[model samples]
Target: MKTQKNFRPFVAAIAAALLGGALAGCAPLLVGGAAVGTALMVTDRRTSGAQIDDEAIELRSASRLREAFGDRAHINVNSYNRQVLLTGEVPSEAAKQQAEQIVGRVDNVRGIVNELAVMAPTTLPQRSGDTLITGKVRASFVDASDLQANAFRVVTERGSVYLMGRVSQREADRATSIARQIAGVQRVVRIFEVVDATDLRQLAPVSTGTPATVAPAPAPAPAAAPAGGAVVTPVR
Candidate 1:
């Protein structure tokens, strides 16, 4: 009976693996849809309009890429605050440039960072390993006390990690350090739009009844006397 119990667990694991494989194709769509819905309701730094634009940029870019490259390339389009990061494999340098050009034309794309390697497409197993590495890196960020984990986006291709977001220099550096410490991460790339902490503060909406700081106007130059005018000064 003990032997049978152990065998049953193994059988259950095998069945679970099979089920996962069967559903693998729908996983990204489901996860991405859920994340987008949740993010809209959360405290993300991006304004709701900017978030919507970023999503539109990603979708448009993907559609354009499909029309241009079809199955000849493996491209992953990630847009954060309208800055797009392109990662994956293309067949040639020409194709790489073409891909970037295509994405650049997408409306609302403020910038593009093309990190597509000029190589053959990676196998499914290799892609799965990269996904695992990305998950580990993301988990580490969540565990980090100093980092706002959602302030960064993590993408892993092969063994290289790509980080994207609008963040202060400190946050970007901290995130890069965390990703580098993960095993199987051979490289870390920063595609962040680095901003000052003050900039972030300025972007935040002022709370009710909070006074806004205004610069003092320069003292009005003493009223210029007419060419030969009276020297009497106005009373203060």
Candidate 2:
């Protein structure tokens, strides 16, 4: 019986050692994978559509809370899997309730977790700056015909602008380009919604610059010229 008990202890030690070694080997792979994922998330102008949607929900929630509570509320919105978690501070019970109401209004919002502390109201200057940043980015979308601004949610932290939107590859590129061109943009993080090429092709390119005279869209029929008249097919 003693020998058998001793054998069990030896077996347990071997098992533990194997498990430790296995975990050690997996550590580097796990780290590498995480690094790659993070890099892709940060660098790729085109990001997964689902992630963009989540970010949109979060941003809209925070923005609505900001509007309803005005300078009274300081809110942070975080989303995961369509669920929004609202955390921050407000000055009163009414303000906290108002924040909840605002979050509820955002579309695609699954659930909310309000963790707001009642405190002093936010300053006028801070609120004004937030409004300015939001208005500028929002107006840019409204003016740009080719871009879908509504698909995105804009969030401003300090001087930085965070854009969240679902988009085609082309739309992602255009959006990033526009954000970069904006004068005060500190950093643009693309929480883009990517779609297939077929869907992307359907999006029309906006005409803003000099007008070009070109042939009309082709009709799906054979064209014939009158007798002695030549039919001209433009050369590429």
Candidate 3:
């Protein structure tokens, strides 16, 4: 049960992000004079295999959620390296917990970070503002010389920015510092998988344009993320 430190009362997301249950799917990666769009298979840290497993996990979880709750919830599922992070809204605490449980049962899901808020879903304007905030944070990441824009995945709910990725402690701290300073951001929630050089080999290989027509993947192996688990940075 996590909470936004100083988040405002309202928030929202882009309609396109609604697909695959990944709220705000991938934010517009606005880098130096270029917008590389959202899906960055080539540069992503997750192995091409893990990335696909994440997508399946999200879709399966979303489908089950829809069957179980329907319009009763507005939940977003984001999985990185087989770890699923739940965000957005649910009608009650019970619904929230239930949502997490349902996703936990999905195939290939190795971990769950439950960040679902217990309340009503966000309105259109709030979602729009969230989209705007995500863009700002993304641009800030790109503008910072020390940061690689795609290394962090940004998801904004209301005015709270949820950053998900595999990064080092310094990168995490630097990204957190930048996110908390944004104009519309009232809180920064970091869901980073902190790792060092030795941890590199444990990750999935870089994406190599594997076709969707490729054969179904085997079950996801145990996560190689460090033993401390997801670094839950204090919401600032």
Candidate 4:
């Protein structure tokens, strides 16, 4: 009976280890599914058409990028409301420039932020670490009560977190603060198209016979395109 009991504990330990390994392997897929489902439920600031356009931009840009650079570059194309943020590494500066040009030709791309470095591609382990950092930053946003976590898109490359969203100044500041607090985030770069509180309020559906409010002042002009085809527009 004692021998059987010892064997049972060993079996239990093996079972626990197998279960842990299974959960670890499935974590990314499960998280991705949850993210997509949550995104569908949220009231995003972008119009439905804009959302579709952003998806299309990512697909088309990626296709073109593959055709141009193939294995020479490791590029990530992320589009939030038609603004594309390109990260990863290329073999040369020429490949980097070509990436931007290819993405620029995609339909409905309002702007591009090419943060691609000219170096050897990052290994899988580095990419895995970036994914974990991104998850931490995203969880921080979800924990903050005042912020609409769904409004921001988090992308991490080599520890730099690129935040893309259509958000107000206050929300942008709050997100930046949260991202900076995360342990692995080396930098937080804002790629937000900043709107005012009034704009955000207007996003809500109006009821019938609601009194009209005064029109808000026009938004400031977007910042000029930065050199090398990366558009980093500051909120004025």
For all candidates, the clash counts are 0, 2, 6, 0
* lDDT, candidates in the order shown: 0.62, 0.47, 0.63, 0.63
TM-score-superior candidate, 1 or 3: 3
Q: Report clash pairs, candidate 4.
A: none
Per residue, candidate 1 scores C-alpha lDDT tens digits across 19-57 of 333211112211111135564336566666667777687
Per-residue lDDT value at 44 in model 2? 29
Task: List RMSD in Å for every model shown.
Answer: 17.8, 23.7, 11.7, 11.9
Q: Indicate the worst ten consecutive residues by lDDT in candidate 2.
A: 25-34
lDDT of 2: 0.47
Off by over 4 Å in 2: 1-73, 78-122, 197-236
- Between candidates 1 and 3, the one scoring higher on lDDT is 3
Per-model TM-score on C-alpha atoms: 0.70, 0.38, 0.72, 0.71
Q: Ranking by lDDT, best first?
A: 3, 4, 1, 2
Ranking by TM-score: 3, 4, 1, 2
Q: Model 4, 88-166: lDDT tens per residue?
A: 8888889889888888889877677778899988888987777667766666676689998767777778887777766
